[model samples]
Target: METININLTNGYSIKSLCADDFNIVKELCEKCSDYYLLIEGVLPSKKDVDEIFIDLPPNKSYEDKYVLGIFKYDELAGIVDIVRDFPDAGEWMLGLMLIKIDERGNGLGRNVHRALSEWASNLGAKSFRIGVVIDNHKAMKFWSNLGYKKIKEVDMEFTAKKHTVNVMRLQLDE
Candidate 1:
């Protein structure tokens, strides 16, 4: 697997997270468990992060999936998972993105998103796709503000709950 290091506008950086960074990844997930619980009705565990680093997603034979650690001045601030050429050609999937509890509502989310967008564009992605729980009002608003539009709603089984997932899409600037 190739390690990617991306520097943000501020001192924040998105770096490749590996098995060795389990603790930091676990902590970041714990900080996001509440949000996941609110929508998926289940708390995220360290094992979830373990699975991503240990096993690759289905239909992906190579290492195109990236579980990145978002760091701000050496402290892990969040985590994100991005996949290239998923569900469609030339499409990038923002599979998972979560900001630390205390770090939300401070414009950090936007920074992380912008940095991800730029990184994907640099890698030749023509569009971005993300799935959001239908009832997640805040997330829907947040993504919409970032220029992603609700394209379709599909049923998704997440953590024991069957959710109506709003598939949002954003056509990147070419």
Candidate 2:
């Protein structure tokens, strides 16, 4: 599906990211080393960058996935990966949403999510879900502040490391 550009209050804009954006994505991922090191216990890899474009849940098509880049003028400031109709119809799954380390703590993440949520809701989304690593306190707090409530905990392996994740859900009441 074609994704539209989302403009933010702070002059940041979000657009669809594709294979052509691999280099920028890699750079952004590298800059956010703290997240990678904390979650996987290692630096980001080429495979990790590649997965942003091709990863999909069972029975989901690539067309259902969206890899979006958040930009500030000409620079990439963050990235968001979302999958439509995952796990169930009308529910979207946010696989990843990382703001450049330098851009954190300024309410940009919240704006990015609000824009994406509006975009998803227009496309028939009834709710949104995300998985936060149990040990990632910052992320847990971020999601909680956005009104996402814990649905359950699940053990999953990512990039050769095992983590217990708190699966959270936010119902989009329209």
Best by TM-score: 2
* TM value for model 2: 0.97
What are the per-residue Cα lDDT tens digits for candidate 2 across 16-92? 98999999999999999999998988999999999988989999998899999999997999999999998899999
Candidate 1 scores a C-alpha RMSD against the true structure in Å of 1.7
Give the per-residue lDDT of model 1 (tens digit) for 90-154: 78888888888888898988988888788888888889999998788888889999999989999
Q: Relative to the true structure, how large is the alpha-carbon lDDT of every model?
A: 0.83, 0.92
Point out where model 1 deviates above 4 Å. Answer: 54-57
